[model samples]
Target: MADPRSQVEHEEEDGASAGELLIEACRRNNTDLLADVISSCGGEEKAAEVLNNTKTVLGNYIYHEAALRGNYEVIDMLLDQEGFECDPINTREGDTPLHSAIRFINSLPPTPPSPDNEPSAAYNLISMMLEAGSDASIRNKANLTAVQLLDPRNVELKRLFQEAAEEAEREREIAGLEAEEHEEEALEDDYAGSGSDSDFDPEEFKRQQEEKKKELAELKAAKAEA
Candidate 1:
């Protein structure tokens, strides 16, 4: 059997094999051939077969090839399928596909397309992986979270990952707050509509809230006086 990388690279060169073809199509952003292949291979099922089960005799998915090439659509296609592994650490280095992509981004020699280029594809893909459930907290064999995978040399890459992590945390907090607010609003609405003042006295509720507010004011006043 061919080496895993060789198999992907060879088929990538030849435009043969579904996996190789899909990776190429994704790299080129050729949604046309992508659609055709999806049609023939039974949509996501055939794609999953290559991704989940097929490996070079050495054991690697063609999907990993797509990721290494920075093909976000292919990543999205695989992720949209149920149960596809978003965080497969390679046997060679215990690095997930996200790690591989970040590694590539960091190691590139300075040239025309420098790391400072606007709105990095790597950041976009990493965001996709995170959204698809890639765990930020998983320490690699190096005991580093995927965020730490960024090269210390590339301050920009580090900043990008930091921003993405912060954004994810902010979104989670926003979602939690929204959920709490929704629950509180629902409870208020329910109480207002169903519980009669005679059955559940408004005066009693007002008195309790007023007392609580007064206590809070006293506590603040005491703290200020101190």
Candidate 2:
């Protein structure tokens, strides 16, 4: 028998291809085919043209598809393409892509998995989008950010996005610190380790490490108590 995915792929090819096809490909998580179409059709520019023709915007296109389907590859593709704006205010609703992504994340049905699989695909996608530069502060037509669009009744999605944003911020901060420390170390090495090779601040380093250990211990205790 013919493979089911192949049959679907054939049908897509036979139909009149357009931006909607691209969107559908994203929704279906068909990254390879999506990339091919986008590349052949001039990528972001062609996508922008489709948006113009459809009276839509690139942000809307990406937000709707990726948000609804938890398609991280598509979201990353859209985010990485330079000059494609995502945080634009919606003309009608005044909603930004961030708002849409949050709304869609909240709407997704929960699919619990065994330990190996993630409990939520939406969480991962949201995290990816944020890391890719989706603005967490952009508000929607309702004067709400994606965080606000989350139903209070569904606290989990709200917490998920919040945690993702916080985690992204933490990662960025850690990277910056690491870079700064590396630069400082490079500078020290440039000094040729001459001015007292014992200039290394062992006390400061130990203090910082001790603080980290204390924080980890507190966290572990909290988790254990919970």
Candidate 3:
């Protein structure tokens, strides 16, 4: 992995960035460079942080750049990392990466889509985003989700979004169940550390009672003599 530290320092002195290498890697489908630089920076999660924090000139996140460029492998690299934000809205357009991908497809010249071609590059991109738990219901500044922006004639994309939405819900449900199970387990461990009155041993109780009675009898005798 090429250390970007020196490049960063040089850029600082001249107020010129060395260029966005990760974006370039995605642009060229260079996963090896992507993995090298990311792993070199840190592990998956740390690399995700660095990439997500950096944006294009358009103020779009790394995911946005990858999706717009139709870089599936790059998107997978970033999205597979833990704690990635799949649905990132660009500052200028208030459009999530899904919306960006959709808009890119919509802008293409009209063509007769078939099952052989209905799942266009745009469909695949949006599907990937949605599968990663992107919220399809989230509205942009225009109060439209990415699905809403689609041409009514494009039934394929709409149905794909619908499936993605369902898959996202299932993912959320599973996550919720896992969290609940963890909470329940913690509660059980906490309770196990705290014994109830019923937990007292009979033999220990009898021994304690006998000792207390003996002490009381001695105290009463001493008081009477006094």
* Best candidate according to TM-score: 3
What TM-score does each of the candidates earn?
0.57, 0.52, 0.62
Error of 1 at 35 (Å): 5.7
Candidate 1 lDDT by residue in tens digits, 1-226: 1222323222333437766566556556566776666666555654445455434444445455566677777677767765566666555566667776676666666434446566556667877887787767677678877668776766655776676676666566556655655665575577889865556655675576566556555555544553
Ranking by TM-score: 3, 1, 2
Regarding TM-score, does 1 or 2 come out ahead?
1
Better candidate number, 2 or 3, judged by TM-score: 3
lDDT of 2: 0.59
Where is the poorest 10-residue window by lDDT in model 1? Answer: 1-10
Distance (Å) between predicted and true CA of 60, model 1? 2.9
Model 1 lDDT on a 0 to 1 scale: 0.61
Candidate 3 runs further than 4 Å off:
1-19, 114-118, 166-226
lDDT of each: 0.61, 0.59, 0.66
